[model samples]
Structures are given as structure tokens and as C-alpha cells.
Target: MQVNTRSDVGGKAEAMDYTKEAIADPVVERSFRGHKGMVTTAAFSPSMKQLASGAKDGVVMVWNFRPQLRAFRYANSKSSSRSPAGKEAASPVHKVSFSPKGDIVASGGADKAIRLWVPNVVGDCSTLKAHTGAVRDVDFGDGGATLLSASDDKTVKLWDLKKQKFLQTFNGHVNWVRSAKFAPGGAYAASGGDDKTVLVWDMQQKKSVKALKHHTARVNTVAFFPSGNLLAAASDDKSINVWDLRTFELLQHYDVGSVVNEIDVHPTGDFIISAQDDATVKIWDAREGRLFYKLHGHEGKVQTAQFSPHGDFFTTGGGDGQVMVWETKFDRSIASIKKKMAMKEKKAGSNLEEAKPEEVDAKIEEETEAEVEAEVKADAKHEGVGERVQAKKVSISEPAEDAEREVEEAPSSITREPEVNENYTEAAKEEVRPKTAPSASPANPSSSLPSTSVSGEQVMSALGTIVNQMNSLMEVVGRFDMRLETLERRMDALEK
Candidate 1:
């Protein structure tokens, strides 16, 4: 994944140091670091003026979004030397929501309580606690007249916002309900839970209108498309399943590499975004069902992904303790530029190929030697373990008999390699078997080693044990590689 981090300094005035891709990186931006635990959710105000985030710490922060966007805009400019500040550094908030007018903000937390705040006010807040368990999700209904909340108690409750009274409790899910979202029209809301079921409730009737049970694992999140005609679901089954609202029939199915924690459709319904356990937020073309591009940059699982009401930008809240804002950018002439660069590299490669084979081989040898030297230096600095473990884990290439033969031929070299620890070599030596066994006495050469050799039987047992251990180690290694690659890709994206 080659990223072009080169930002253009001579172009548009509104352009800041931030690229649309920068929004995808988890690094590069050091702001919004207050959350002490993994952030579980985030939402942007309808006006795009405020951002709300919630974390495992049972705290949520509602900050001014405009300044952060501007700071990113000026991050690469000569004026970027100035320090940046935020509107609010802390809040006693958990899950947050903005009213239709983007005035009042509502937050739910582990305290089994919900709080509403009037932003920028001296002392204005209303607290409500009706659920018996921590609230997992919250959303405002049509015109902010109603509020929907789901909890670990396995119930979804509708509340009258003005009266601050619980209106109804809908219960059908057999387990803890993890998420709930009001449909675009507020006529309905969808709830998903550990029971691997999604219940669509008709707000007016106060009953489930549909029960979707397609996921093989726990359902994580659900959302209604802009038209309110379709629903997108993310589940522990490691898939995103879209369903039609009119017929209540399953529609498209897309597999993300790991647990899909959250899914949101763009306001325009042209794209969809998924937050996954792999620490990646991926964007997909909704209508065409094609991957647009993967947005990388979260050090931990992406807890939530949402698009702004205007469809110009999207926000992501990550377990890494930060929120990111991504927007669209136009690449006017990237195709022409890449074509020219490709031709230049091709011409240079052809010119170099005309050299003598020995010289070319020597150059190749020199590069290889340089690589080996760097590897040795890196090993001396303690960078050998991770890559080596990853190599052994992935093992895309088969284990080489040549290396085993070389180890057999020069046992001392294997033991002397500076890259391997002394204890490891000693362990290998203890495990190695001699190529040939000692002969019996001349009178009975066939019975030299043992009367009835059990060594072969023992060797087979040891081989089986080793094979089992290797299989277990490979599984562990595969998980590590997936996680590490995900992290690196995210950091690289942030750096870009």
C-alpha cells in the first residue's frame, strides 16, 4: 500500500495540510486524547458543528468540530506553528446525541443513567435513569420529540423527550441488546442483540414489525438507509448484511475480514461505511456493492462510523481513544501524473537492463548484501523477533529443505548465528537426531542400538507433539499478523 503523502502547497486556498486520506489515518492527529478507555461510539451534529464521542471509561465529550477541521486545514501551512485548543476538554458524558436543530446533546453511560446538556451553558442539564443496566445505545426520534435507548437488560425503551418520561418498553430479544437506531423517518427503529436477531419496531404500534434472524453470530449494529427502504447490519458473524424494508427480505451480503461492529450508510445513500474488529473503517459503494477504498488509521477496533447529514464528511470513533473526520477530495489529474511516472520508471529499468549480466548480478548481489547487513543491524537493535515470528507464522513459502540440509552440514554455523539466541540453539541441538545410529557389536550388528528399538516409536510421538504445537503456534501467529498488519496500515494511512 504505497501512499502519496505529498501535499500540494501551491493550490486551493481552502486546502489545509489535511488530505481526504488523512482522515483515514489514526496517527498524524494528536488531539481528542482525553478518553481513558476505548471509545465505543461517536456522532456528529446535524449541522456538523459538534462531535460527540463515548468510551469504555463511561465518559463522553462533545467538542466543537469546526476548529479541528480548521486545524487540519492549516496543519501544513507556514501558520501551522501556533498551538491549537479545543472548546471543551472534558465532559461527564457517555453516549451522545444532538437534537434535530443540533442544540441539546444527550448522553447515556455505564451508570445506568442518561443526561442531557445544553452546550456552552453554565449549568443546564437533565438526568434520567430508567434502565436497570448500562445503556448501550441512544438515538433521537423525529424532531427530537422522542428518544430511543437500548440496554444490557435486553430491552429497548422509548421515552418522551419533553416530559422526560419512559413511554414504552419493547422486549422480544432473548439476550442483551447491543445497539438500536431510529429509522430515517422515526416511524420505526431497529434493535440488534447477542441473540443474533434484529427486531424492527413500529414506534406507533410499540411492537416489533419484523424479526430478522439471518446472522449466525451476535448482531452488533443496524442502520436504515437514507430512503428508509433498506437496513444495513453489522454482526459478529464477520459480515455486513443488507435487508429490504418493504419485503423484509435479505438483500446484499458483504464480508469484512473480522467482526463488523458498526455500519452506516452515507446521507446520499451512495456509499456505506463499516467499523470492524480489525481496526479498520472500510467504505463501500452502496448501489454497486463494490469496495471504494479502505480507510486505515485506528490502533484499536473502530467502534463507530457515521456520515454527516450533508454527505460531505464522515466521523469515526475508535477504541484508540480518538475521533477522526474524513472528507471527499478531488484528484484532478492524478491519472496523467501516474502514467508519466510509470513510463519514466519503465524506461529507466530498460536502460539498466542493457548492462553486462555479471555487472547486473553484482548490483543485485550488492543490494542483497546491503539488505542482509541491515537485517543484522536491526537484529542487534532488537527488531529481529517480530519479523521473524511473522515470517514463521505466515510461511507463504514452504519450509526449505535446503536450509535444513545446511543446518545438518554445518551444525556449528547454525549454533553460531548471531541472530538466534544461545538458548534457542541449545534447544534445537537437544532435539536434533543423529543421521546414523551406532552399530551393534561385530557379533550382532543388527541389535547394536536396541534389542527392539522403541526410538522410532518415541520419535513418531515427539513428531506428533511438535506438529500439534506448531499448529497452535501458527494459529496464534496468524491472529497476530492480522492485527499487526491492520495497525500498520492504519498508522501508514494516518501518516499519509
Candidate 2:
């Protein structure tokens, strides 16, 4: 099932260059195999030397990626040893993420609590609890001073990492918030949810400023590009939507023909990798809005895929209880350079073989240079194609013709009807209120009442007003109850 890279040979060469064969495909460099249950999520540290993974068994394991000091699992106590089988049960962990410095790791899951651990520490240093339902995802802020968690309770909460306390809660999605991530500079946060909407929140204002609705099904993941101005979202609708964060405009829509579970943008900002339910990962050229390569390896739904900080490698976790590390072919170019230098040295020491060492070295150098030159030429070709693709404005145009063509050519099972707008009307929008104190009522309420004319529009408007008032009252009540609960917890802490 491997594709041959020899077909795209470059210029004529005196000897057959085997370097191309060495880096033909993105072969698996390693497979992590300790999780007793499905690996729910995995992420590489900023240094790319360590990997943190969370599994259904609630174990958060950090691997050094080297053989000697292999891995350490966080337990309930101050010990890194494996928990006894008959001891306290472990909760299923849904997400694990490393902070920007890679010094801290966060995990959250079915326990409805978020725990923070230092990489080499034995147990969690702190725990934050607020979500009422299963926590679906967790992410660290830019400076690692704050953390964000998404939960099935339909809210995303920001926590102060230093204080280990809840700071603020964002409520916008009407359904479970599946994923939340801090923008590059941490000025804003983006969240996607079962409401089929992507929300960009103003962290300083503590409110949602923009809501981007495009997906037909639940949005599973949202990621901000490295520049922080482009945001990408993947969904169960079999499409990936790229938006310009500054303008909130849809920049590109790639219909992947399968349910996209997750997506990671390369650090170069030129490519995107999407893991799909079809057990395949597709790399797309961001500038061209076209497929660059397809990686096939996973056996079941690929739940997660992440590019290393340096973009030299990428990892994927699947439902089949496998985590695979893949080496990008682009990384091989650098290896080839080193290999070429070594070949020259080897040829110099091989005069006893009866071949002219200098000639052999010259021929090998020529072949190596030719191979590298060929790669450069191929890159130029891709760039030229990208320029042409951009010139056509395929990614920027509304109702992209190229995307439509892809959809038409796709199999029937992969194609579906386009999404229809289902946003609430103006009146319905007014019916929902922010979770804050209610305003004082007017003194002269009779003066605000409409005249006795009873048209259908008037009746509907009156009903909407009543609903809005009810919503405000309910929000007030809920806030009061939450305040009481907070007070109770504080009193208990004081007593302890």
C-alpha cells in the first residue's frame, strides 16, 4: 500500500541515486503502545522531545521519546508507579495538552475536573473543578498563566493557572462545547460546538464578539493559524472551513469527503493536515486549496493529529488504540544533505576497489546535487501551481467552483446537501439574556404597553417580549444559585 517516489526522477544521472528510495513515503518512525484503552488525545511538547497522551483509562502519561527514561504516569498520589489494578478506578480522560513552555500538562475528562501536572512530577499539583458535565477538551493560554476547558455543560471556562481557580465562564453555544483554544497571542479564544457554530470570544471583554456559522453538523475542532489571523474549523459535515479572523470572512472551504475529526496547520502556514474518519490523513496546500498528499496508516477513526512545533513530524491517535509518529518527507531533504557529505568521505577511502576515487566522488556529488536540485525544481513547480491557483481566486470566491467540482466528482456516500442557515430570528435572539443581574423595572409600566390592536405580528411580538423577560429572570436565578454554591465551597474551605 506504499506509493513509490522513484517515478518522479529528476535530471539524468551517471549512477542510480538511492536517496529518493530512502524517503519515498512518510513511514512510521515509532508507535506508542502502553495505553490499555483507546488513546483519546495526544500532543507533543514545544521542544518535541516529549509526548503527552490521555486515554480512556484516565492515565496521563508523558513519554520522553527515548528508550532509557521512557514514560511516567500521573497517579492520585505523589508517586509515578503504575496504579494497582484493584485500587481506585481511573476516570476516562478526553483531552491532554501541554503549556507553551512544555513544563506543565493539563488533563480533563469524565470526572468533570481539570488537573495540572508538572512534566516529571509524580502527581497532579492542582485541580480545578467547575464544569457540571464531562470536560471535552483543555488548552493552555499563550503564556501558560491561564487555561481553558470545554465541557458538555455548554460552557467554556477560563481558569487562572497560578491561583488554580476559575476566572470566568463563557456561554454562547447552545449545545456541548467540543473544543476551545486560545489564539496565538492569547487576546482571544475560539470555540466550536455541537451547535454547528464557531465562536470567537474577546477574552478581555468576556463575551463572544463574532459567531461564524457554516457547518451542517457538529463542529468537532477549531484551530487558529500560527499568525493568529486565520482560523480553521473541522466538523462532522465532511468539510473544513478556513476563515479570516480579522474580517470573519470564509477564506476557504475544503470538502474532504469524510468526517474530519481534527486538523493541524503546518508551522510554515503553507499546509494543513486533516485526520478523517476514513482512517486517512490528508495534507492540503493552504495557498492552493488543493490536496498535496494523503497518508494512509490508521485502522479506525483517527481522533487526533498534531504537527510538531518545528513541523518536521506529525503524530496521529486513533480509535484502534494506536498512536503513530510520522516523519515528513520534507525532513528527508536535510538528511540527504548529510548523507551526500558522508558518501564523499566513503568514496575517498575506497581506492582499493579499483575505481577512481575522485571520479566516484564527483559522480556521487553530481547525483546528490541533482537530487536536491530536482526537489527544488519540484518545489518551484508547486509554487507556480499555487500561484496559478491563487490567481484564479478559488479559495476566496464565494461558492468555490473548484470545491463544487470536487464535490460533484466525489462518491455519493461522501457528498451531502449543503448547510442551511438555522440561526435564531431577531425576536428569538432577544429572548436569550446574558447571565447577569436583571435591570430595574420601569415605574410606569402601563405607558409601555401597546394599544389594543391585536394583529398577528403584534401577538408574536408580545410573546417574544414575555419570553425575553422569562429568560432574564431564569438567568438571574441561575446566577444566584451558583453564587450560593460558591459561598458554600468557600465556607467549607475556611472550616477545613
lDDT of 2 by residue, 1-496 (tens): 2323222221111111233434444557888888777777889999987998887767888888877886888752222234577455678888889899988889888878888888884644688889998899999985899999999999999999888889999999999999999998899999999999999999999999999998999999998899999999999999999999989999999988899978888887877888889877777768778765667667788888898988888888877777878876644563576788789878865653555544444444454434433443444355332111111111212233553553343232121121111223443444443333457443576633543443577568667755754453344334333433443343344335
Per-residue lDDT of 456-495 in model 1, one digit per residue for the tens?
7656765675564455444443443443344334334433
Our model 2 lands, by Cα RMSD against the true structure, at 34.7
Q: What is the C-alpha lDDT of each candidate?
A: 0.66, 0.73
The predictions' CA RMSDs to the true structure, in order, are 21.9, 34.7
Q: What is the TM-score of each candidate against the true structure?
A: 0.56, 0.61
Off by over 4 Å in 1: 1-31, 66-94, 121-123, 330-496
What's the TM for model 2? 0.61
Error of 1 at 358 (Å): 71
